[model samples]
Target: MPTEETQTRTGEAPRRPRIRLDQPLTPRRKLIPDYDPEAFGRMSERIARFLGTGRFIVWMTVIIIAWVAWNVAAPDALRFDTYPFIFLTLMLSLQASYAAPLILLAQNRQDDRDRVNLEQDRKQNERSIADTEYLSREVAALRIGLGEVATRDWIRSELQDLLKELEEQQRSVAKGEVFPGDGDRGRDVDDR
Candidate 1:
């Protein structure tokens, strides 16, 4: 018998599977290494907090004043960024640029945390409301069920009614209107 592969291919060699050469085989590496996003966010928050403090402002002012004094008083050869203080201005601007984004990032993270906390609080409030309503319903059901049950006052009233009827029956028997051994025959004899 002919081989199965030769029979199907009519003596032609088996075809190789097609490959997609246009696409990359492996993922490309990033220029910078990956870092923990949460850590970065926390760092940005700390930086933003420090930037907002009065201490930071005081230190920055002192440094700028010292820089200006040095540049103005120092000899020409030693001076850097003289009269206009262009370098100092540029450094402040750069710090401000970086500060703005870090502060905004921290605020966004805080907002996200607040949103999650609010959602959790809302769910807890809903659960509390549901529990309160369930308890209220249970209490109402118990009240209604207890209304149908006999209580001490109700038992006392029923016993008092039975005692009054027995007293009336005893009075009739003492007047000879009824006898213990007979039913209506005693009343009939009395009538006769």
Candidate 2:
């Protein structure tokens, strides 16, 4: 047995006492009997499912009709429930009492599953949006880079301009006019 007093070390202020993490927890006897909750939940779901089926409704209707017919037509000694049908009403009420909870339990389980699925879908949509945004940004960057690069049509136009400049310089030299920027090409051509 350990005392409930707070443990303190030197130079530390007293804090609220808590259970020791290093020690094993003591087993407690519960007031209610312990059972597997998961198993019970599954059983309740099964019952709820059965109750919702058309076959269950048909069977219940047939049984009730038979019960009514038997009590109405059968002799007094054989009939268990008479004119008021109190026993049938009690049985139906009992069944409703149990069925309501089981149906609610099944609905709760379905709600939990739906909530988890919705969360996963939301996360998936978020990731998809992020991926799409990232891809779009990458595409935009590539388009910008491609715009900066010289295309074949631009290169062709630039080469045509250079050719026209060279033709004009040749004509000027042929007419014996000295073009200032012709440099070594003019001298080399004259020597040739």
lDDT of 2 by residue, 22-124 (tens): 9999989899999998999999999999999999999999999999999999999999999999999999999999999999999999999999999999999
TM-score of every candidate: 0.78, 0.73
Cα lDDT over the full model 2: 0.89
Instruction: Report lDDT (Cα) of residue 190, candidate 2.
Output: 53
Off by over 4 Å in 2: 1-26, 174-176, 179-192
Displacement of residue 70 (Cα, Å) in model 2 is 2.3
Q: Which stretches of candidate 1 lie over 4 Å from their true place?
A: 1-28, 181-192
The best candidate by lDDT is 2
Question: Per model, how many backbone clashes are there?
Answer: 0, 0
Query: Which TM-score value belongs to model 2?
Result: 0.73
Relative to the true structure, candidate 1 reaches a TM of 0.78
